[model samples]
Target: MRPTRAGTIQDAVARCYRAAGGVEAVAEQLGLANSTVSYGTEINEARPGGIGVNHLARLAMTDPDCALPLAEFFAALAGGVYQPVGGVAEVISLFSGCGLMAKECGEAQAATILAATTQRPKDIAEAEREIEEAIAALTKSRAVLTSLQSGAA
Candidate 1:
């Protein structure tokens, strides 16, 4: 059967959580602001019983991929037609790479590269040069990551 939005969101979140070692890591991988992911987790934790559609709707607005059908589900609950939110797959795909790298390269190495890419250096030219060097280094790391992915490590 084809995957649904809700299923996809759930899967993506779960995979990210597992790969990143936690929701914070997942949030970082997703490029989401830490406060946002923390708030969402807090809400979910507070409502251990369950949160209503309305609450979920609010969450979807803040973090669209938080749940499935996401926009539609929220809309339907808000007395509107179900309108799907597109591009969630792309978001998931992008974040999934971090998880893949984490799994393949080990968290320490993955974190090193992630930090390097996300940081803003004092000198733009220097940063660019550093990034180029990092990319070149990836030629070696990629071989290792690839082997790890293939279970050859």
Candidate 2:
């Protein structure tokens, strides 16, 4: 099973600190105190209370290379999966990925009908409509992301 969002965030904090050398080094880079960074990187079930939102924002804003990873880290914390691409968060890309999956599911249903099961056309049509709804959801999600990116959401 996958780790919870809190666990993922903790892991990311530790990984980020390691990437920057150590807690001290990361603190120096992030313009924060060593104790703060140390507390944030500690493994725990809840979020690192020591690392405030402002601190996290500053880390992403100041460190270009760490920006998207930090965004993904935050997204995971919010129960969303936003992968990084070229140091940028590919939020819109998630919609595209879901669209592809829905398309494939529709196609799979058709293939399955041809191959074995004696499922009724209504069943196949219902599955296809469900996939269509998923595609529609992707479209709506993409629109919302676009609006957010354009500072209109």
Candidate 3:
């Protein structure tokens, strides 16, 4: 199965730390103990939990973009994806994007039908790529609709 764009928590946390200018800078920025940030950014096979929500919030307050991947990391666990919606402009874009999303769905459906009974490896691979593209479009549309539903944009 394809991994989510959010990647693993280790990946997300490390990205945040990197964006905040590495462990020491992040620790200083967030007023955290050096050990805490060090532990938080530790790359490991174990699940991530060294960072607290409050610290994350503080970090996010200063560098919002840095936290987005981490938000996506958790959202994907709940079978959802996170997209930043910048109120009116994004809302306008979402509506416009819907038309393109519909086109993608049609393309996906055609590809799936074409590959349905095919035994050829290449054909199947092409269909898989098409379907993934369509899925991404649909997921974006869904997120847009969800934001509207929640009055977020």
Candidate 4:
């Protein structure tokens, strides 16, 4: 996955947290920016609390097997490949395990979860839509490729 620019201060803080290894690490690495990292971490910790109407709708559109790659993809984004945050390695580790199923629990659901935990919404609905669309297109393309290969054989 390609890296995305850190769109919000929260995104920047998350990047810092990942780079520094949790909130404390981020603070020390950034030279006394601990409070910022701590604040960001606290906000992010509240996103998983509730279910929303949009979340349920998105959930209805998802498949079960697509979560791991999605998480890894998002982790990659958070790791600052494009944006170059301070402590990306740590961020990658933290986000790498978010399975697709967990990640795909619908945009609103995911947002709600994130909001519940972190008190901030990551605005992942657009990304989720694109991913789902991409997955479908890829699956179709793969099926076509397989068919062509078998036919040629």
> Residue 103, candidate 1: how far off, in angstroms?
49
Q: Rate the local accuracy (lDDT) of all candidates.
A: 0.45, 0.61, 0.71, 0.40
Q: Assess every candidate by TM-score.
A: 0.21, 0.45, 0.62, 0.21
Error of 3 at 84 (Å): 6.5
Q: Write the per-residue lDDT of candidate 3 for residues 2-117, one digit (tens) a residue.
A: 12234666667777777787888888898888887777655544635467667877887899877886788888999987755444443257757788778887887787777887
Backbone collision tally, model 2: 0
Tens-digit lDDT track for model 2 on 2-98?
A: 1224545655666555555667776887787887788775555475434766776676676655555566777877898663232113335656757
Model 4: per-residue Cα lDDT over 1-153, one tens digit each: 112234543444344335334556534544545454355433343542122224222322452222223333356767822212222222222233233224444543555555556653354554546456444433344444455578731
Worst 10-residue lDDT window for candidate 1 reads 83-92
**Whole-model lDDT, candidate 4?**
0.40
Q: After the best TM-score superposition of candidate 4, give how far the Cα of residue 135 lies from its true spot, in angstroms.
A: 1.0
What lDDT is obtained when candidate 3 is compared to the true structure? 0.71
Candidate 1, residue 118: lDDT: 70
How far off is model 3, as Cα RMSD?
5.7
Any runs in candidate 3 off by more than 4 Å, and if so which? 1-11, 42-48, 80-98, 119-125, 139-153
Decoy 2 TM-score against native = 0.45
Q: Which candidate is the best by lDDT?
A: 3
